[model samples]
Target: MQCGFAAGSPCEVTCTRVTLPDLCGHLFLDWNFSFAGLIVEEGASEWQLRYAFYGDGDAGWVHVLVAAPLAEKTFPSIVKFVHAADWHEREAEDLFGIHFEGHPRLGDFILHDDAWQEGVEPMRRKFDPREAMRHRKPDEDWRPHRIVQEPGAFVMPVGPKYSGVTESVHFLLETVGEDVIRSTPRLFYKWRAIEKLAEGKSADEVLLLAERFAATTAFAHGLAFCQAAETVCGANVPPRAMTLRVFLAELERLRQHAGAIQEICESTALAVANAHAGICEEELLRISGEITGHRYLFGLLTLGGLLCDLANDACAKALEKSQKVLSQLNALEKHLRVSSSFLDRLEEVGIVPERTAMVYGLLGPIARASGMVRDLRRAQPYLGYENIQFDVPFEEEGDGYARLRILFAEARQSVRIMEQAVGALQSGNVRERIELRAGAALGWVEAPRGGAFHWVRLDGNGKVARYRIIPPSFANWHGFHLSVEKFAFQDFPIMLSTFDLSVAENDR
Candidate 1:
């Protein structure tokens, strides 16, 4: 059934409350079990109650908040009803401080303990950051630890520095013989607080910060942030810009996925496959630079529309290069798939089941590799993706091999999308001058990792009020825990790298 809520309302009240089984049944019918949970987000004030219905899919999840004051007495039952939505409830409790009476695990989801005083809610609107900082100290207790072991257990640590020149992240692996007992990831080493710094900047300025959230997915972040800003201003982008945005977004996917597949090859000691994949990635990056003047495709998107129009000839040249690069990459991927050594390392390593993926709300390639058919580009269409045709890849094995194959398949699909988008590109105005308005809006884009979300609110004078960015890395971090449970210590690096979790994106 279609929701009857109007566009302008902050919340919509759904009188019907179904049991978990019935809710799951409804989700299966409509969104196809993409998401299966309920949550509650209270208003800023003490008395206002709002409930949210959250659903998960292989691609991403959706949240719809209902307007109504939640009865304090009923909060416990509500919390228990959606036990699978622990992270969501914990986040709501931490930010809004709306107690989930029966919540099994409720604590700070992101904030360090020293970052906020005990019993003080750091994310609430009324909490003063300066005052909180006064009481805060750097949390040195943020190190990773493993389980106590008998004779067979071993501990392995991978990187504050890695083999490749990449961002800094560390993984702690615990194993007994060849089976991994636990894996713990340590993040926040690259925390920039981009959301906090964006407080007083103009929407345009925040767009710059958004682009830097991740080097690989820069265009994706810029696109999502710009869409949020445009939504807030009620500005409509020109069709040409929209088409170009889709083109760049797919291009970003191609580059990132190519890099991922190459890394997987390198991990499995397949030198030939790795070299071939690396060459394809460099070519993809070069094509990005040819099309947008930046290898990473940053600064192409702005608040109203594109920073500048694309040259038609440049677009054509980039398309031709991409087609050639993709063909070569496809041949290499097929060869790697048949290689016994590579298959041996990936086939059953770092397995994450469909049920666990759902509990952790894995997104993008990770969730797709686990037999989940979720693709935000298809599920919640934006940036002309609704008009474009593509398939959501899925793997039933849910192992390192599955994730690797998914990335390879997605790279091919992204190339297909780029080809179509480039063919349809028209020579026309790329931007429409839009007047800024003081309002709030939500924007989301399917970044290479998963869904990158931006919530932008503008002040009366056209300045940013509050900017909340929830990158895919933050949501998928839970998958690390789920995947590491039964894997061996040596497999941790491959498993971790397979997800390609971006610490910079998560820390921001």
Candidate 2:
């Protein structure tokens, strides 16, 4: 399949597949025939290609791919795709010294430029850590660009702290009176250098790190990372492990969706609806915690199989809880929808049209809200989701309200899936013990946000030679800019909080 945009646009830009004399190339190419933009970064033996297309508004979409040299023994390259996907690409350039040719603006997306010496780049392979430690002064020139500025425009900065405790991230809101004209999210407050730190770690050790990439999406990331490791190692997980993995993945989805819906209610100022959603979320989390020791369902996955077996009693208990929560959530959703105030605030607010969604390549609830039916779980069934039946919720409105409704519907479907999966659990060895060999693998899992992909290459000693992770947040980050366009300033907080994007996930 030709990987192209789905919004009736054709990509005509093609690069010359030639050998590079130097380690990197930096140049920006503009497409004459389409609204697409191409950023090409040349490595020692590969070229990283990023395809970017502008949407109807200020938003854009980007897809990344690496063209490797015909010869073997070349280092696998890293390419950042979306215009808003800055942190990942910046990390890639910093670590590998690969230049982003046509990047409109590229600097240290994660590490502040002011944090290093005048000419030193800390992420390069040859960069010394001792020197960085010797000269640790905040870079005075590290001032981020303010995106929106006009007459009567004022800034409303939110977070780095909030009324409710959550991850720390700063949002720079550009407002004209009550309407939000532009919004920029300042992330990297919780940079954990996950990929760079994983270098040379054993496959098993790296799997643990992958699981911790995101507390909420631990199982999904672990599954994707392990599957990639298994692919490279040529290890085969048993059917029972695969089945259990599927069940756990869906369970994670249910919990996350429930929490997101609750957050939506909170954003809408519906205290009663928010409280009910919160209760449902707690129930889902408790069920997951009971089944797997971790409340977020972490550590349930291994390279070749699950860490342990799924208990029938635990499955039954989780299913029963889900059944009860579903009934209550349904009733609450109905009431919230009927409330005029809630509907008035949400409906058509932060509207992202279908065309805009495609341009930004929005995923999960954000994409579904725009009428795009692209779910990796359904489109490419990696786990046992192929056998399980469920509907992918979609809406044409593409507004905050539509996103809320879609999340509600997905939560109900997730419960139905859990019910079916719990009944299907049978007595068997839930794990397959096998020795992993040396190679490379690719693993993908449909996280609550969207698709999470992991590419892992192992050395002869079964250690990770290279690892790359693409979380769903990397795809949906651009939607923030799209949603804030043409909305009132006060609506910025509600719009941003509605998406509930994880900066940790993106920065990692």
TM-score of each: 0.84, 0.83
lDDT of 1 by residue, 1-508 (tens): 2244444323233332333334433444344444323333234433333232333323233343333354442334243433335555565565556665656666645554546566665555566655535557667665444474678777767766865776776667676667767776656667666766787788788888999878779988888888888887888888888888888888889899988888888777778888898999998988888778899987788777798998877877888888898889879877887888778888887888887776566778998899867677886677778788788889998999899888979987887898888888876788888888887666778899987777777888788877777778877875677776776656666777788788888778
**CA lDDT of every candidate:** 0.71, 0.68
Cα distance off (Å), candidate 1, residue 225: 1.6
lDDT agreement of model 1 with the native: 0.71
* Cα-based lDDT at residue 122, candidate 1: 50
Clashing pairs in 1: 34-56, 34-57, 35-55, 35-56, 49-69, 49-70, 58-374, 59-374, 180-487, 180-488
- The TM-score between candidate 2 and the true structure equals 0.83
Q: Please give the distance, in angstroms, between residue 245's alpha carbon in candidate 2 and its true position after superposition.
A: 1.2
Q: C-alpha displacement of 7 in model 1, angstroms?
A: 6.3
> Which regions of candidate 1 are displaced past 4 Å?
1-4, 7-11, 14-63, 66-84, 92-99, 114-122, 126-166, 170-178
For model 1 the local lDDT of residue 129 reads 58
lDDT of 2 by residue, 37-93 (tens): 223333456555443332221122233344645232233221222333344445555
